[model samples]
Structure formats: C-alpha cells, structure tokens
Target chain A: MLPVFDVVLAAAILVSAALALWVRDRIAAVSGFLVTGLLVSLSWLRLGAPDVALAEAAIGAGLTGALLLRSAHRIPCAPSKALPPSLWCAAGALAIAISGAIVWTVTSFGAAPVYPSLVADNLPESGAQNPVTAVLLNFRAWDTLLEIAVLFVALTVVIMVAPARPRTAPLGPLVQPFARVLLPLTVLIGGHLLWQGGHAPGGAFQAGAVLAGGAIALGLSGVIGSKLTRQNGLALLAIAGLAIFALAALAAEVLTGALLGYPAGEAKTWIIAIESALTLSIAATLFLLFFGPAERH
Target chain B: MSELSLLVLLPFLAATLTVAVPGRAASLGLVATAANALLVVSLCREIIARGAVEQVIGGWAAPLGITFVGDGLAAVMLAMTAIVSLAITAQAMSTPGRAGFWPLWMATLGALNGLFLSGDLFNLYVAFEILGLAAVGLTALAGTPMALRAAFDYLTAGLAGSLLILLGIALSYSVTGRVDLETVVVLTESSNGRIALALIAAGLAVKAALFPLHFWMPAAHSSAVPVASALLSALVVKGALYLALRLSIEGGAGAEFLRSALAVLGTGGMLWGAWNALRAERLKLLVAHSTVAQIGLIALAIGVAGDPLQNGLWTAAALLMLSHALAKAAMFLAVGRIAEALGHDRISGLNREELRPGAAEFAFAIAAISLVGLPPTAGFIGKWILIEGLVDEGAVHWIALLLLGTALSAAYLSRVVSRCLRGGPHVSATAQRLPWRSGDVAALGLATGALLLGLAAALPLTLLEVPFA
Candidate 1:
C-alpha cells in the first residue's frame, strides 16, 4: 500500500515542477524549482535514503537554487516570450503524457536488485562502514575520480566563456554579522560531516557543499571580498581534488599493477586521505563554480 | 599505468598542465600531441599483436565498475583523432588566437579518447558531456556574437541529447539489469529494451547532427575559428557516430529497425546537404554543409552494412571517416589561410584577378579532390570499397544514389576548385604576394596525407582488422 505522506509529497513535487517550468516570472520559476528540489529531498527521505536526501537538500536545493536566483537577478526580467497558446498546450500535454508513461512503466515493471548483496559481501574490505561511502570512495573510485574530472571540465569551460562577475554591492549590516557567526559554525559542521562520512551518511560531497555554501555566503555579503575568494591559492584549491585523485590513482597503479587499486590492508588510510583532499577541492570547485574565475585583484 | 590508460590519462594530464600554465600552452600542447601520437602507434601495435586489450578500473570487474576496451575499431578511431588533433595543434600553434584553445583542445582530445575506449554506457555519457562542453567552449572562443549564439544553440541541443541518452541508459538498465555492451544483446529480447535502444540511437543521432536534427550544426561549425571548426567537424561529431556504431554492434537484432531508418535519413541528408552546399554563399559555409553530406554518406554506409558480421562494410565506413577527417581538416585550415589572403571567404569573391591563388588554395584543391573521391586520394579508395561492398549486396538503387552523391560533391567542390585555378578579369597582372607560413605547410601536409592514404590503404585496413566479434 502506498503511504499517504508519499502521495502528498509526490503531488506537491509535481505541482512545483510544473510551476518551475511554466511560470512567466523568472524569480517565481526559480522559487518553484527550489521548492521542487526541497520536496524531492523529502521524497528521498521517505524512501529511506538519508544520504541522498541530505545531498538533495544541500546541493540540489541549496546550491542550485542560489545559483539560479543569482543568475536570474543578474539578467533583466523581460516579459516571457510567447509561443502560440495551442502549441504551448500541445507541448505541455506531450510532456505530461510522456512523464505519465514513464512513471507507469517504472511502477509496473518492478525487478529485483543485484547490488545490495554484492555490496554487503564487499563491505568489510571497502574501508568505510557506510555502504554508500564505501561504494563511492573505494569500490567505484574511478567513477568518483572521473566525476571530479567532469566538474573540472565544467570549470574550465566556464572560465573560457563566462563573463566576469558583476561587482556586488555590500549587503546590509545584518548580513555581514550573520555571515561572521554562521561561517565558523558552518565550517565546524562541515568538518564533522566529513569525519562522520566514514561510518555514516555524510561525506566529502555533502561536507564540501556545506562548506562551499558558507564560503559563498561570506563572499555574497561582501565580508570576505572577491579578491580573497579569487586568489591563486583558491585556483589551485579548485583543481586540487581532481589532481590529487588522479595522482593517487596513478600512484596506486604504480604500486599495485592495477589502475586505481588501493594498496592491501591500508584501504581506510588511503580512503580518508583522498577524501580529505577531495573535500577541500570539492568545496573550492563548488565555490568557484558559484562565483566564477578568480580575479587578480 | 598501462598504455590503454595512458592513451586517455596523458591527454587529461596535459589538459590540466596546459590550463594551469599560461603562455606555455602551445609548446605543452604540441609535446602532448606528439606524445599522444606515439601512444596511439604503440596501442595500435599492441592491438595488432594481441587481439584486444580490456581493463577493469579500480581492480573491479563489470556490472559494478567501468571498463576500457581497446579493440581494433577503437584503435582506428583513436588514431584518427590523434592525427587530426596533431594537425590542428600544429595549425593552432602557428596561427594567432585566444589562449583558451590549447586546454580545451586537449580536454576534447581526452574526452574523445575516453569515449572511444569506454566499455560502458554510463562512462560514455560522461565522456560525451566533456566533449560537448569543450566543443561549446571552442565555439564561443571566436568571441563573436553569432558564434556565441551558435554555441548557445549547440549547448541546448547537446544537453537535450545527453538527457535522452541518460534516460535510455536508465531504461535499459531497468530492463536488462546491466549497462554494459554485453547486456545489450539481452536487452533485445524485450520491448522496453528496444525502446531504450531506440532512445539511445535517437540521442546519438542528434549529437551526430544527422538530418532534420542537424539544424544547429552548420551555423555552429561555420562560425567557430578555423581550428575549432575543423575539430568540431572532423572529430566531435564523429564521436557521436562512433557511439552509434557501438550501439548497433551491441543491439543485435533490435538495431535492425534503427539501421534502416538511418539509411533513409542519410540519403536525404546527402541530397539536402549537397543542395545547400551548392547554394551556400560563403566558402566556410559550403565546407560546413559538405560535412553534413559527407557524414550522411558515412551513416548510409554503416546502415547498409547492417550486421557487424560484415567486416568489409564496416571497414569501408571507418575508412570513409578517416579519409573525411584528413580531407576536411586540410580544407578548413586551407580555408583559413585563403580567407586571410583574400580578405574574405565569399565564394563569389574567390576569383580575384588581382591575386593568384596561394598554396592554401592549392591545398584546398587537393583536399577537394579527395572530398570528391577523385583518383589517387584516400577518399577515392574509401568510396571504391563502399561501392564494391554495395554492389556485392546487389543494392543497385543505393549504388545510383552513391554515384549521384559523388557527382554532386564534384559539382559543388568545383565551384571553389575552378575559382582557385583560373583568375578572372579582375586578376591583377602584378603578382600578388602570398608568403608561405607554417600554417600553410600543415594544411598542405594534411592534404598530402589524404592523397598518400590512397597509396597506403593497407595500413589502416590492417589496423582495423582486430576482429569485431
């Protein structure tokens, strides 16, 4: 039987998704997207995947929403361009129909999963108590490594094409003091999350995201200033995760004769070391992505 | 690291270094390109000696981890990428442009290498993202409004395509319980699997810029700077088509429908692209349109080839891709020099009587000959093999279409070829000065390679014989 809360959350998610897609005002659309992301996080929680739920709330809802809102504010809000209403309605109908078909297909075709048993079997050797963390950092480290490469590529592309960020005006006195108090606490929590990731639900990605949020908050309020955020040190930090990860892979291969093969009996040490570096890099990359390339000034 | 991993990692490492260090990008990129070419040779040699090499990343086997496969087909594609990239790198170094080109170019190379070698569906999608974003960055490097606009459109198309591909992978995983190529045969047994395969094929078609879906291609291809245009036309689009070929190989019986549809669309693209090329006002626009037609021909070959069991047909397709890459890169580089000399790229203005066509124009003519499948060129050998294979299959109508397409290519290319050879009334009696640059040398060398490949047809064909099955 379907749970009542699940049904309500799903419906709310759908409504917010529709609002995000159809709203004429850019700001309203962005808000809708944020709401949808938050609702999706709730759904993830209901599905009993707290790790995914936290990630959804932080990265998907928090970071993405902030990015969208900032961009929307930067671009002048013109009246939404209109297509023929009939055409719009047809597209809308088609989208709805396709989505309905997809949901129906998924619900109707339930199959047994193979990963759980395999993961359970390999859990002890994976160096992390949490299956998700183990899978992310040990069993499938190559994916994690390449995923960082994807982020690096994004940063490279943005650096090549994106215009310089417009000069930000100072926010009110409240924002500065709020950021000062919030910043240290955010860092502390982020570090805790990073530490907890080995045997629990929190990891580098979530921790980095939270840390990045704090950094962005400080930057946004003009308390830290763009110059500090955009320094050469920051640039190096932005790429540190990818570089370190790649080097570690090569180092592992050199020592073990297999690509990304961690040395025997030292998995936990290596995983932790890699995660620490990744945490820094991911935070820097996320911050850079939000703020654009570092300026010399 | 094994040579297989190095083939991808070296370029990635180069990309990082090239981006991290400024003003040194040119030399670093060149060294990387040269190193990469050597790596490809070693890889090809290894493949030739051994049947195929496969590696599981992080010491983890498939169904749970990614794999890299270096088969004959992949090696051939990698070789082509390396060659074209080498020429582009040489051209980029000699020509003055934005500092952003080297890192992006290297990243694209890394992505292309990854795409070719990746043995799983999900990894290929990641490679596609890198390729797509890097290509878009290259497009916008022109820094012109039109270029930026075209990049925007290309981005939209690419993202839509990526989403479709991701959805297809998800659906296929749901149906077949796995995401690797071996599971694709299993996917053919069910309706859901077929739909998933279809979605993947459709997405790849968009990226490959196949007909009807190719609306954004010409503008994006033409508006980029010369090296960017060459890479986009010669390598980026081919990456998508390569994945499609891989799909067809794995799809087994289910791919039959997709192949037939491809053939039909390919024929349409050939005729339509030719018509547009004939009418195109600018030289670069004509070249871009010709890419559309050439791609169509290659797609048609793949479609007609049908099953992977027919090695000859697939080889023909691969050869055509190789020949086209060489000829097209040469043509674009030559066009860059020609446009620079002529002060414009308008086809109508190409017959400047005040000036004699320079070595670049001569390079264009040679490249054009290859494009038209004239004698003593790689294009001719590729086409000859394709025609022979088609004839063996007793597909007469396809033969007629192929011949007609050939004639159409010749006719359109003659527009530039004739203009370059004969000076009109406006030709100045005083000899025009056209100093030879390294860029021209690189273009001519590539054109020469296209011509030489005809004489050395055994090389790539032998390399391509790594046994697909």
Candidate 2:
C-alpha cells in the first residue's frame, strides 16, 4: 500500500510538472505548477520528511504560487509564435534526449548514506532532536544566514529595480474582507511555526514566508495601498534581522571565544533566540520582496 | 571568529542598511559598500595573520552542520569583489538614471559575497538565485529597448542555468544525504557519486560563461549601462567560476575528470571569444567579448589542477580576476564617457575627427594597456604566472593558446586606444564637459591599482596558503 501510494504521488507530480511546462497559457501553467508543488509536498510526507513537506507546502505551493499568479496578472499572457518545422523537431529531439539522460542518471545513482553516522553522533551535541533543524540551524547555520541575506537582497533588488508605481484602481471588495479574516490567523500560525522549529517541523524560513503571505494579502487588499513614496521606518524594519544576527555573532566572539560559537551548555537557548530574531527579519524581508518599496500616500 | 560567517554577513548587513536608509540613497549605498570593503580587508588581514578561518554555523561542526570556511582563495576573491564593487558604486552614483541602481547594486554585492563565502550546496543555490535575479534587474535598469531585450534573454539563460544547478543539487543531496560541502567532499571518493559532481560542475560552468555556454553574455553585458556592464562582465560571472574552483578543490579525485572537461571548454572559450572580439564592430562589444576570453583563461587555469607546479595557479587566477575586474570596469566607465561625448559607441564610426585628448581618453588608454597584458600591469603578472606554470607543466599547446589570445586581445583593444588617440586637425567642437571628477578618478584609481597589484602580488599570494596548500 505504501509503495502504491508513492507511485501514485510520483505519477501525479510528473504529470503536473509536465503540464506546467507544456501549457501555453501563463495562468494555467502557474496552476499546474501549484499542483505539482502540492504533489511534491505529499511525496515528501510519504518519504517521512515532514519538515521538508512543510517547507514544500509553504514555500513551494503557497508563496511560489502566489508570486507566479501575481506576475501572470501583471504581464500580458501572450503565446509565442510557432517555430518553424525544423526548429520544432530539433527542440523536441533535444527535450527527449535530455529527459532520457536524466532518467538514466537518476536510476543509476547508487544508494549511499555516508553522513548518517556523523549526523547521529553530532545530533546530541547539536542541541536539537530534529536532524533537519540541527542541520539547518546548527550544522548549516551559515547557509541559513546567507539564505536570509538572499531574501533580503532579492527584496532590495525588487524594490530598487521595480519601484512601486501608483495604481489607478483600489482593491476589489472580495480581497479586503478576505484579508481582514486571514491576516491575524496567518500571523498566529506563523508565530507557532517559528516557535516550534527546534523540536518539530517548522522553522524561521517557513514561518517568515507565511508571515509575508499575510502581509502581501493585506497589501493586495488595499488595506495597505501601494504608495508612491518610500518609508524610512519600513526600510529599517526590513534590515533588522541581518543587523541583529551580525551583532549576535559579534557578541558570541566575546562570550564564547569564537565567532558564531554559542555558549556550550546554553546552545538551545541561543539558537532559539537567533532563530526568533531571524524569523522576524525573514518575515519582514519576504514582505518587502512581495510588496516592493512602500509608496508614499 | 570564523572568516566565513563574517564574509557572508558583512555584505548582508550593508545590503540591509542600503535599503533601510531611504532618504539618502547614494550615501547609504556608498556606506554599505565601504563597510563591506573594510570587512573584506579585515578578513584578508585575519587570514593572513592566522591561517584559514573555518566556522561551522551555529557551532555545529562540519559534515553534520553547514560550515563557512575561508581560505586564501576566498579571501582574495572577496577582496577583489569589494574593490570592484566600490569602484562601480562610485561610477553608478554619478551616472544619469541612477536613482534605482544603488539598492539592486547592493543586493548584488550581498549575493556575490554570499556566493564566495558559502560552504554548502543548497546555500550556494540560494546565492545563485539571488545573484541571477539581481543581475537581471541591473541589466534592465538601463531602461532602453535594447537593454530590455538583452535583459530578457539574460533572464531566460540565467533561469535555465539556475534550474540545472538546482537539479544537480537535488541529485547530489539524494546520493550523499547531506548538503554540506565537506560532507559531499567526503562522499565523492566513490565513482558512483562522481557523476553527480560532474553535473553540478557543468551547471556551474554554464553560469560562469565558459565557452559554448556563454551565448547570452556579450549581448547582455555590452547592451547594458556602463556600470552595469562592468559589474556583470567582471564580477557577476566570477561568482560561478569561484564556485567551480571551490568544488574542484573540495571534490578531490572525483573532480579530476570534470577539471579536464573544464580545460577543454575553457580553451574553446578563450579561442572563440578572442576571435569574436577581434571581429566585433562595437567598442563595448569588443570589451565584452574580451571579458569572455579573459574569464575563459581563468577557467583554464583553474582546470589545470592537481599538478604540483600549478599548485599556485589559483592565485594567478585570482590576480587575473582582480586585474580584469579593475581594467574592465575602468574600460566600461571610459566607454560610457566616450559614448556620452561622441553620442555613439560604434567602433568604426567614432568621431576621431572631433575627438579631444582628455581624462576619459587617457583613462581608456591606461585601461587598454592593462587589459592587453602590457608591462607593469596586473594583467601582465597574471599572464606571466600562467605562462610560467604552463611551461613547467609542459603544456605547450596551452601556452600557445594563451599567447594567441593575448595577441588577439591587444589587437582588438588597440583599435579603441588608437581611435581615442586620433586628435588630428579636425577635432569635434561639441564635446560636453565630463560631469563627475569622482568617476574619472575612480576609473583612474582602479586602473592604477591594476598595475600596482602586480608589483605587490606577494602580499595576496602569501594569503593563498590555506587548507589547499
């Protein structure tokens, strides 16, 4: 039964992904992608990676879908002109060859779990029961910090390059009521996810993305209109995470005698504190990425 | 303090500050870049003062946790990135239509810093995405039809490259069960895992604009605004090349085959790029194509791994990258000024009849000399080390190719230099006053640094003796 479920989910994922790529209509393709993300999340759950499944659901299905939908609405959904027969044939052949190569390569990969013993040995010292969190927060904290930076940078680029222009029309009626109901619940859920990251299947990134989703919902609903002017306070709020993290690391050097080295026994507390700060920052950064630069009223 | 964490965080803090300080965009941007530069300099000093700085993020040690390791290689790259970024920021501030350039530029700076410092596979992917998006935005900031078209093509290419990289990362993670660089390095001892590493390298090479994968580069770089072109050509592409180098160093014997493949591609790129650059009709396009050739040279140097004689080759590549960054940025800025004065950038159609010998023209000559690997310049030093290494390795073919590439570069660059030098009786009367002394000084300073860096190579080379050595 388990094997059957895996097969079914895998099949669904493949079909949806293919449709997402092949569909001509931008909106339809985006919906196909959303479905594909859902299937991928399901597959992650079936594989016993609930944390990854959570991330897939929030980031893959939720945030990415929203982004695609917004972009699709912003840009006209024009289809490309048909390619000549020879070019079409060549493209098809190339696609088939690539698919074949990918399949062959994936099937040929030998099973190897070299890091299991290492992860198990270090799991205790990592101050987290969940290996994923241990890996994400402790073992690979540099990556996470930089990933936060990536989000921050992306937001900055979006704001700087695509400055918020004045919108002619206000939000439709449906969006305001929807946002009013959804925003608080989203904030609550996001807080829970962030707080639960150490022991369970939620973390700063997933939580932050969720928080951004709520903020975006509010912004789109005209509760927060696109103002043409920049907000200094919001800008400062956006960078709070990075500044806090760097300061914490600097403090760590003074307290623990190494950069980013937490106090030995109080590792969990420090990790949580850092994670909490990161969560707020991540949320703000993601919100900025979505809303762009806040325009003046 | 771990050199790695500092390397990543410094630019990030700057990026955040740049966006946060809303009213004074230019000053905020400058402060961010300047702060990052100071951090990079300090990091370099630390590496030189100590050995390589290694930190497992969150106090988690390697193989189980993510690690940030900074060696001589990373330090040099970071320093170079800081320098180029500072110069570009200075230039961008004075350029027209620079209202939105600072924030995106800062973001790009942060992403580049992250790319250089990251020691995990997934983290590297995230950085690549950030860099790719920022670069695309920067490309589009020129706000011309040509710039938009070029940016769109660049965006598509960048996305495709990123997807390939993502696929490679997923495959590697599946095989190794960990995303940490050290863990993957340990796992690559087997032949079965080697293939996954190769896929990752190929994806990286595509983004690095090596040879056949560089189809989107010249158009994207040449068509954008001058500062944008400089950043894209000199620094943005180097992020991927730096990754390729890091992977080759960490992957051990599993990467040998991949390195050979890179050598082939690099040679192809060098020859092809040089040939195209020579035949190119536009001055900016010529410089852009020359960048392809220069990047190819660096890749080739990196690919000639595992030989005892070439143990110091990475330093040579680093120096080459630095020289290229400075010279290229200066060239682009000079071209911007020249184009502004002459009202066009077409090579053959440059109004030599009306041209005057000024700061822009002088800066162009200096940049051209450095670019063509002339004496006393950093470019010459880089070429010298490469040629010396090639001779020691008995790689006559590579040496010949290098010499040929250098000659072609000189020929193409000299065309612009000579054109600017043509101050005959019929000089143009409509030349506008060059608006920003700071811009010219920045270009001149960088061009001078390119030359001065060669004489002071010992300082940076001393820092290269980290884990790799």
TM-score leader: 1
For residues A1-297, what per-residue lDDT tens digits would candidate 1 score against the true structure? 559878988999999999998897889999999999999998998898988998999999999999999889677766667799999899989888767756654555634555678789888877899999988998777667768877878887776676777668989888988998989998998999899999988999999999999999999899878787557688678777777887888888898887877888888999999999998988988888888864421
Residue pairs in clash, model 1: B353-B426, B353-B427, B353-B428, B354-B427, B354-B428
Winner by lDDT? 1
Candidate 2 local lDDT, residue B37: 83
Q: Pull out the clashing pairs in model 2.
A: A139-B65, A139-B66, A140-B66, A227-A295, A227-A296, A228-A295, A229-A295, A229-A296, B354-B427, B354-B428
| DockQ of all candidate complexes | 0.54, 0.45
Worst 10 residues of 1 chain A by lDDT: A104-113
- What C-alpha RMSD does candidate 1 show over the true interface residues after superposing them? 1.8
- The C-alpha TM-scores of every prediction are 0.96, 0.89
**Tens digit of lDDT per residue, candidate 1, span B1-469?**
7877777777778877876786699999999899999999998898889778898887777767778888888998999998988899889988885857887898899889989998888888888988998899899889889999999999999989988999988887777667777777766666666777777887888899889788989999999999899899989999988987787777655677778878888898899899999999999999999999998988887787767754467677888888899999999999888877766788887786667777898889989988888888878888888788888889999889989999999999999899777767642343345687777888998898888888988888888777763
Residue B258 lDDT in candidate 2: 71
Candidate 1 docks at the CAPRI level of medium
Q: What lDDT tens digits, residue by residue, belong to model 2 across residues B1-469?
A: 5445555655566555655554577777787778788888888887887778766555555555555667788888888888888888788777654545666777788788777776778878888987887888888877778887788888788878888878777777666666667755654665545656766776787788888999888988988888898889879999998888787777765667777887888888888988898888888898889888988888887777453233766566777777888888888888877777766777775546544557777888888888778878878888898788778879898888778878888888888777666654433456565655678877887778887877887777787666552
Candidate 2 chain A has its poorest 10 consecutive residues by lDDT at A226-235
